[model samples]
Target: MSLKREVLYQKWRPKLFSDVMGQDHITVTLKNSLLRNRYAHAYLFTGPRGVGKTSTARILAKALNLEIDEHGEPKIDSKISEEIDKGKFLDLIEIDAASNRRIDDIRSLLDNVQFMPSSGKYKVYIIDEVHMLTNEAFNALLKTLEEPPPQVIMILATTEYQKLPETIVSRCQRFDFRNVSNSEVVKRLKVIAEHEKIQCKEEILWFIAENSSGSLRDACNLLEQLSIAFDEITISKARELFGIIDENISLKIYKMIIENNISELIETLQDLRLRGIDFKSLSNSLIDVLRLGIFTVNGATEIQGYSSDFIKNTSLVFSGSDSRKLITILEKFIEMISIRTEHFDPLLDSAIIHLTYMFENKRIIKEELNQTQEKEIKSPLNIDTQNQNKNIETSENNIKESKINDTQSHEKGLEVNQISKPKLDSNEKQDWEKVLFDLRRAKFGKMVLGALLRNVEIPKKLDEKLVLKFKSKSLHDHFKVEWQLELAREAVKKAVTKVYGNGIKLVLEEPDEEQKNNTKANLLESDIVKSALAMGAKVEEEKEG
Candidate 1:
């Protein structure tokens, strides 16, 4: 049988300081130090994994043990270099601290530190994942690292620098390797593909780079894996291997949400679930496209893997306002997904429903505001009043017009979402259920606001201040947004006026444990509350006009 080829990561490992990609800050400093013959005895290399930490350490070892040219770059085609590559070099000892992390192992290492180089100029010890060493082992290694023999150089590499002792870290010159950018990773992959004679598309390289998460070795390995699996690498094959959802599917879902087509959106999500699409990937892809849409709205046009036509279409589908709202909602959805849960299907359905409902309601509210612009019902928060007299006239006209519209709407079988002109008799009691019922018919997307208030209760009712407490923390958090709080206050103002014959100041709060228990006990004791609870409530969905 033919000898198996070495893996791409090993085959394409950096050999010289100049060859390390995307970490010029560390490499340049090391090169200058080497050239000046002022390199430290111990070094600490810290960064994310697969970003050339070990390779850089090995290269440093080779430089220290071998003679370098005037440019401070050691030739890699020598006998020592070959031996180092094959792990046969006596002077260059690479240890995986993860496995050999006991005090005995470190003591043995300290015993070896006193010896001179057997053949090379200096003995180099590279301890990788150095943070995995036990407390005793770290303590044993500290004295040696602080003052090693003149001929010995200790280089420590760890992904987690925080786990390392501060005393050990303070003894060495630290070099932090940065992640390889996608563009740099793609450029490096192109060089490799050309060298290996692999047939692949540029987009496929980009796909690999994106999924590798800034690790050049991961990108190279993925590219090699694809080359071996397929005669020619393609996007479809790569996506299938990685379980990545297609961008078209993500775009379609975005379109459905923008168009407020909830039925089709749910059907599409169900189809993807049936076909075993990774929901996390789908969510991430949609977030990317929505981000792209925001960029397009702001006149950016160079997003990768997406055509100008796609950008143009995305801009048309997701307006600036739509992008902002969808992004906020999707961010929350993704956060919920991040916390591992078994009921992902139901969670996804609920998220999609929430997204579409919020989008549709905001759009409807915008349209209604535009249609009523001629009436000039200026919100006190948005527009400045000319004076008290003008404000009073505006308020009186608004009340009179609302009364007339309420009467006319009753005739047309459309209930006006406003306070009635007359109040209840003195003997009649105010009803919380009636407030919620009236809220459902309030104007300017108050129906959506009413749905949010479904679990709200008056845990602490004070005169002039209505403390509406939320049972669901999520619902309570929604009101923390400034605009949502304003909308809630407006809906409550109308609903309370219709039910209690006057509007009170609104105070939104989350129910504490004691308040929650007290509210529950009060609900059980009240006949009206019990009857309302038994009857239950349904949110009034906005109908197409």
Candidate 2:
């Protein structure tokens, strides 16, 4: 019978330090230690999956047992190295801490520490996934790691260095490996293709590298699958075979986002789903695109795997501040996919809608802030009551001129309708009270204009115009915004028309200190406030400087 084919990952695994990809810092340190004859008794290798921690451990074992030259240079015996690689060498013991993580298994392993090497000068123990060991197992092994026999070398490898006990970690010499870069993964895959005599395109290699997420083993496995499935790998074939969400599709989706085209985005997503494209794969691709776009906008140049045109076109759609917001929003959408997929379409659409509103709200708030800053710079601490009364007509004219041809100039026309009264009569005061009381039926703002008008006297005729004097500039300013102004005008006009069939045209004004103080004192001593105070309510007086 024919033997099954060995996978590329195992068949083409790096057997030498020089063959290791994207880990020069780690490999160089270990080589230097070997050259100087200063190797540690116990070594710890930590990194993410498929970054070759276990493979490096095997290389270190080979360095320990390999024959040497007169210059102390280690020469690997391929036969013995192959035996160790296959876990057949009696002197080289390998442990899968994940399955044999119990303290009893650990104790059984440690009991063999006293025995001598069967063939080589040293016995090597390689423990994979060391963090899987239980607390008792770790405690049992700590002393041995700290004081192993001169002939025994312990090599511990794990993906999660943080989960390993500090006591165990401190006892061993630790080497940290980084995730392999895309370019390095591509380079190694290219070597595999040439060695295996496979026909693969450059874009196909990039697709494999991207989908691998920086794991060399995963990239090799992907390549192996593709090589077995197809005689030659093409871009379209790779997309179809692996359900790869092509960059063009991602770019089109980004264009929809930029244009706020929700309908097109949904349709495209649905079509892609119908074509058997994986939503998770598409999400991953989109995350990469968004990250690249952010990098492009901030003038960051570290990211790759996308074209410059793609980055520039996507990044140009947003400003720097907006790009950050978009990235935050996109990250949230990506997170939602992992939590739940049932409501993905509607949820993503809703998120996009909210993002558009957020952009508009930020613009409005910034404009308001600027207008407020300008107003604060010009407004002063105090105003004379008489001068304010004099300036009211002229300032009203300026405001009117700035507005459209509205009925504001019609305030002068009201003079012909009035009977030239000097003081407000009881009937007119009742009319003002009716206006304030009826505002509840026509309210438009949060602050009740009725309650605020209580701090001011009833409307009094002042020359040609009727004046509404508020106790403070703050109160007057609060009601000075266009919406508040319109609300007050409509309420008063409607109430007067309803009560007496005619209303006096009026303007709001702020009282001077003397009148303001008098009005405040009258309000405090009013029947309601006095009744509350008589019922045991305390009033705190302001201590003015």
Candidate 3:
């Protein structure tokens, strides 16, 4: 006998309103609407991916048009349900705006929507990624979507609700499909684990649930991926597969940052990069652990996955304010991870413990601001008009004076990022390391160009130009590449001006004329090239004639 095989996600996909997880409020409302026989003409199901926007639409569609049994309950027609689930129902139309986002597509859809249902009571139209539609397409869709025939029901689904026009959103009953909560995800995963007979640790299930970031679809997908690797999944197997950092390592990093141990923090981050852990994942895990620490410190027990000893130890690492600050910084770091794929050195350069005391600075500034506002509020009427005018004038003068001072400093080559067309002073020179670090620390390139620079070591300075000799020709050739060369030059100049108080020229070795012509000579030996040459081929020269 052949064993049945199916994807875990597809096999356990919800077929009924009650079967949907982490969306009781939505499902309950949907069930109530069906129970009352109150049908909405259109619905805008908006939320993050995998929380069942499309799935719920199918369930709602089935409920709306399902054949009824004697008891008045919607009869379970497996074939029809399967068709709807597969988006193949004759009356159920599924349009992906990502592919068919043109006005013509919307017009075609509008033309077809006028017709009545062939099989059931209602014809359901599901438009996925509706936000991707062009403005003209949206205009064409507006009339149809707003006032479709009573028998026709439209379900518009989108991950980005904000991308949808307010005009469209206003016309339909909007239902937000929130990301599945971690607990709900965990509960569902546990059920699947038991069904699959995969005896995994509770922590493994929680880890999978947590990592999915509230997308139940993502959770299901992750569960399926794990299933491929393990008959009985363990936490270690999951961690290694996911490249999750150890608890001890996480604690150490957090502790080091909180303690303002910049060097240690940088070293730790470098080691993490060496191990090839995804920075995005590592950052997320750090945020989770810190959040857990906060809850632990506050004596909140609702969230699980942290032992008392672990929590207690973590709780001691940071105060309430410190924890909040660290969380904010980590959140920012998490966001930055999406912009670029960071290598080892760039990761350190991008992140450091230098700003660990930011909380104190912010707190002090807040206190000063509050005090000033309080004073102004208390004694506002007491001041004479003349004094008030004088005070205003003084404040304005102070602002002007500060601006002038900044301009002067920039002129004197004191400010690094001065954009005032400032000139470099002859007295100053570039601190190559610090300037390079500063340039790399900010957003520079898509890849870690700064990391590559760090590998090149200190550059040799020749009066007007700085000559950087890479250990190998490949590294040298990277700078010579058309796109990288200019950006590299700009970065080098910026660093030179910042450290040495002026931009310096970048000098690189050029390939010899013989070497450039060698490629053409080599290509002539090939049979194809020989035939092309004999036929008077217009073989392109390396440089312009």
Candidate 4:
């Protein structure tokens, strides 16, 4: 029988401080401390997983006990050093706090910490995922950390440093590790590929690096899987194995959107569906491409992975203003994806179709606004309470102007028909109340529209436009849907006709961070939230949409 081979991540683990990649700050500091013989008794290593926290702890252990050169490099050929490398050193203890997270376990370790090293000069203990320890275990360990034995060195590693007790964190010397950058990850992978004699395309390394999200261990594992699956690793094999959508497909999708080729776009989407392409991954890839495009348009140079021709085409397609709009669109899409639990196919299709005609829609809306501004009709029943006489016509034009002539609306069967209006005074507040009341009292689909606009900021009579400022994004996003927005626009115009008259555009403003926080505070103080709080329900803060 053949001997089992060591995994690349394990085999390629760094043995010296200089061997650690993308953590020069921590490595250099640790090396300095080792050279000066001033290393701390208790150390805390915290960062995202697979970023060499454990490996660094092991290296620190070897450095503290083993013989080192003038540059603080441990002599790995020594018997004790070899034992540490193979995880068989008696003085170096490795504990998985996730599995052994009890007061008894901690007490047992503390008992061992008081004893002198069997062979080495100092006893080294590495506790990984230390945040998983219970409160009792943490309390038990705190005293030892506060006054540790002179010969004992404890290294605690955790991915979630926030969960660690402040007392424990304050007692230890902390070192934070950061995610390895893609370029650095690529270089490291290339080094491993050359050493391992793996014949793989360079793109395959980038593919692995991109997917690993800066975790070198993840990148190495992915590359190892691909290397094992094929004699010579290829991009197609890696992508197919991982179910990753090809960048070329994403590039084609972008081109289709830029060209507004709905027919071809739909055809391509259908083909992707037939080929079992993951829409979620495709969305992410498009977002990456859009980000690169934005950077390339904004004077960034030497961008990798994308060809020069692709960069030139991207720059030609997007201006500074278009780049901002693209960011907004991407944000909205990401928000939609996070909030909704539905499948990605429909959302992907909707986003692509919307982006395809977004330019045309903006152009049409601008032209309509200009025409409305140029041609104004006199109002038949003008009640000017502000003493500012303005030529404002009926809001019939505003209602139709807000509707986008697109297939999405037609498919949804949405239409804005004229509704009988009740005459109102020129007071904007009264007009808002009356409009909201009409929406609530009307025998329509649900009272959703009224509930959505209950807390909206009402414009003043002096205001030329009827701006609808929502308190929260949930309400704003719901109201900003094409069909819902048109419906609300139609109703608000009809109700506020006496105040603003014609050429009054209905605007929806996205709330700022301050507004969102203020609104959230207000909601928390409401009776409903109070009741939930009384029922032992805690409100955790969520990410901004």
Candidate 5:
């Protein structure tokens, strides 16, 4: 007979409450309950796998049945601990509800619940994957659950709590287990590596922790696999074996975006694909990188699995707002990749092309702005005179001039410059409205436009500064403190310049208290408010009194 390589309970598993990593609240509560003899008849342990759901259940069982030694500490006797460890305990029944989900299985189990335990004090039943039980089986178990035998204790574990029936859930004491933190997972992995005498780098263990995504069992399993595959664990070998994209690739992609190198980005993606890189996984990895970039921008230096070079390079390349924008783009790409398996290569190509084009467009706009500013500083009078001359023509010329003038004027101000909003004729306002409507329909455009709409107002006539009134000084302060104000100001300038002509200055102002009060009072006296009041309905004013 061959001995299995499976981990035994005593060798690696946590023996006491304090030994369990990453579940302090749960362990503490469970220990108090066992110490006070306030154990529940049924328990529902739900969380991501390997965060100590089953392990906690077993520990609870041991605390409940095991006797105290002469030293006044609980004694895990070799015989009882071995029986429980091997799943051979007469009173401890560990059932996989996933495989035995029939009503008959529940009935058979419930039929045996009447018998008293032969040795142990309590009949501990640990039913894993309890969510997989059939509706019929759930109903069959409900009666016994509501009133189980005096010696019976049930610990039901499931990954999906939503799948369980409400009746069954209501009868059990539920504890929600959360995903382990990156630090906690790393800490546990370090202990495991040390125990196995594995010469693992901290970076390698951190990678395993991050890749495991908060599952300790998964992390341990990955570590064990890596240890067996290589004589010693190295960061380079782990990245290769796991098919993880090198941090250099992620940094290069970010640099390409920053430098507006669409061709290089596409070529890079092609090179990676040729190396048998999984586009979907690569996309996901890109999203993670962007996410970590965001955290780094926020001054978080303890992100799991990130190399020192990655941190330093990402910090150098991305500003806070830039990281935010990248996160948004990566999120969109992730959603696109999730549903798109067949067209992965094409999709990757499209994403690279789209991002490259975006970067190029931004670069062009920035260069144009810089040139315009230089021209303004050097020859402000020339720009004004040329724009005025362009406007002073026949009706046809005026139309052409308006188009040219608006394009030139708004070029310096549009934050996200995708379209050229031309001047309107008789029905052009309606067309402009349609264009705005379409822009607002787009996800990114909508967010930017929505902010502008809330904060900015248009007035009739050119050279007349547009008024921007905010609801709160905090909003005004935030806009001023962040680049959002500059971005918003530029967008409005573009829109106005597109509609009017060059040399239009749009001013953002904070309205005085008197003006705000008057505006609020007028709104209260408006027909809408009066009509609602006339219908005997109570209406509270939204604006300050």
Candidate 6:
């Protein structure tokens, strides 16, 4: 029979300091301190789950108790390793502080600490989730902790250090464990896969690593589950098994949101719902997708395993400002979902509806801005206003026309003043392109320029009005707030004026229904499916539109 997962975990688990991955800092410090005969009476090991806090605690116990060779060195004895491996070390006592969180438990443990060890120089007590201990229990343990028996060592481990009383924390030597990086997790997973004789793709492991969110235990658990689920561990199979949303689908969602395809987005959501996907997970996945889109738009190409097409397409779909807006929306969605999940209320429906409505309104505003810019370009305004001054000389024709066609000429002059006129020579165009190129090169500039290029359409003539269109109503509405739109407009104006002189008016618009509906439908289908898949929903292909 194949080895049980838990048994395998026991067999492959870090047996020594060197076996633990991605926690070298903690391990090395402890080892050095132990070797030098400088040992803390109490240690507080805190971090996120599966980063090796408990494992390190156990290792410390073994390291402290085991005999050293004549060279004043701790021998890497297999017998000691075996005893610790089976948890039969009489001197080492492991306790789940979560369940035994009472004064009696602490008193009992403290009473036993006074006695001489049955074996080895030190008696080690390893308490997991020490933060869960009651105040009375902590108080009882405090006196003993402050002046513990020289032979006794206390190792306290917790995921949430903040929950523990400050007094208790101050008394102990603290060592923080961090979440394992994706690369580290991937590396470990690859090792496990090799040992298991499992055929797996690196991308699949990468996905597992990403989804594990820095928890080695979580990644290992997921890998084990997937290995059991699939006979051949391919990337596609991993995606299906783990409910990973495809990058393409995520990109589609970004486009839909940008394009403001509400109906299609809803339909896509419904499709996901039908596939037994959790709404909360879907929302979270969408947020991650948006985050990735934002990263791509900002030209963060170093993100591991992000597809070239995803980066390129997302860069085209979202501007920096647009990405910020999407982030805001996703945040709100998260908030709403969190509140809904926590407390059942009729107001949640209203909240979702209001949010959706605002999103649509933003799209409409963007369309309107785009249209305004277009109209402004097609009909350049020209106006002239004249005031007669006794000290000034004026032409007779101007004076005559000022009186006879004052209203029409004034209106025409106003129109001309409002309309932007470009005076760029070929040299100027080249200069402007260079400026654009430079802007694209800088990190901040790339984000700004990418957003501008995606959302704002520049006219051929330098004098023509600049039109800014948004794919989503939410973004359009968000753009109206404070200096966001103004800043973007100013940036473009500055760039143009630097090269071609300042003769252009900038206009922002929202598109018409027909175009929006069509775009929205296509975008919604793509994005929803992508987002769903990313969140780990299984997608079944249907007839294409």
Clashes of each: 0, 0, 2, 1, 1, 45
Superposed Cα RMSD, model 4? 14.8
Q: What is the lDDT of residue 376 in candidate 1?
A: 61
Per-residue lDDT tens digits for candidate 6, residues 454-486, read: 332233332233334444433333334312333
Which residues of candidate 6, in runs, are more than 4 Å off? Answer: 1-5, 67-74, 319-323, 330-334, 340-545
Error of 3 at 398 (Å): 39
What's the residue-level lDDT of 389 in candidate 6? 35
Residue-by-residue lDDT tens digits, candidate 1, 231-336: 9778888988878877777778877876688888888888888998877777778777767777776778678756678787777777645344556765685587
Model 4, range 1-545, lDDT digits (tens) per residue? 86967899999999988888889999989988988988898999999878899999888888888878888878777888788888999999999999999999999999888788999999998999999999999999998998999999999999999999999999999999999888888899999999999998787787788899889999999988888889977777888888988776887887777666789999999999999887888888888877877787678765776657767766665643356567777787677666555666887788788887755543444465566556555334455755422223443333332322222332343233232232333244545655654455332232345544665666433234455655555445445552344454455455556345655544455566665546444554457744543333334442433
Cα lDDT tens digits for candidate 2, 1-545:
76966789999777788777888998888888888889899999999999889888888888889964443435666677778778798988999999999999999999999999988879999999999999999999988989999899999999999999899989999998998999999999999999899898776888789888789999999898888888968777877877777777776776666555667767886787677676666667777776766776777644566556756666665443456466776778678667665766556545544554435534544466677678778994575889877665554453211121135442332111212113444455655655655653344554455555555556665433455655454445444642235545566566645654443445455556564554343445357654543343333432222
Query: Which portions of model 3 miss their true places by more than 4 Å?
Result: 1-5, 67-73, 77-79, 258-264, 299-302, 319-350, 355-545
TM-score (C-alpha) between model 1 and the true structure: 0.69
| TM-scores for all predictions | 0.69, 0.65, 0.60, 0.65, 0.69, 0.66
The CA lDDT of each predicted structure is: 0.71, 0.70, 0.66, 0.73, 0.67, 0.64
Candidate order (lDDT): 4, 1, 2, 5, 3, 6
Q: Least lDDT summed over 10 consecutive residues: which range in candidate 6?
A: 397-406
Clashes of 6: 45
- Residue 11 error, candidate 4, Å: 1.1
Give the alpha carbon lDDT tens digit for every residue of 410-463 in model 3. Answer: 222211110111122212212454554455543343334454454343554434
Q: After superposition, how far is residue 67 of candidate 1 from its true place, in Å?
A: 1.8
Q: Is candidate 3 or candidate 5 better by lDDT?
A: 5
- Model 1 CA lDDT for position 56: 90
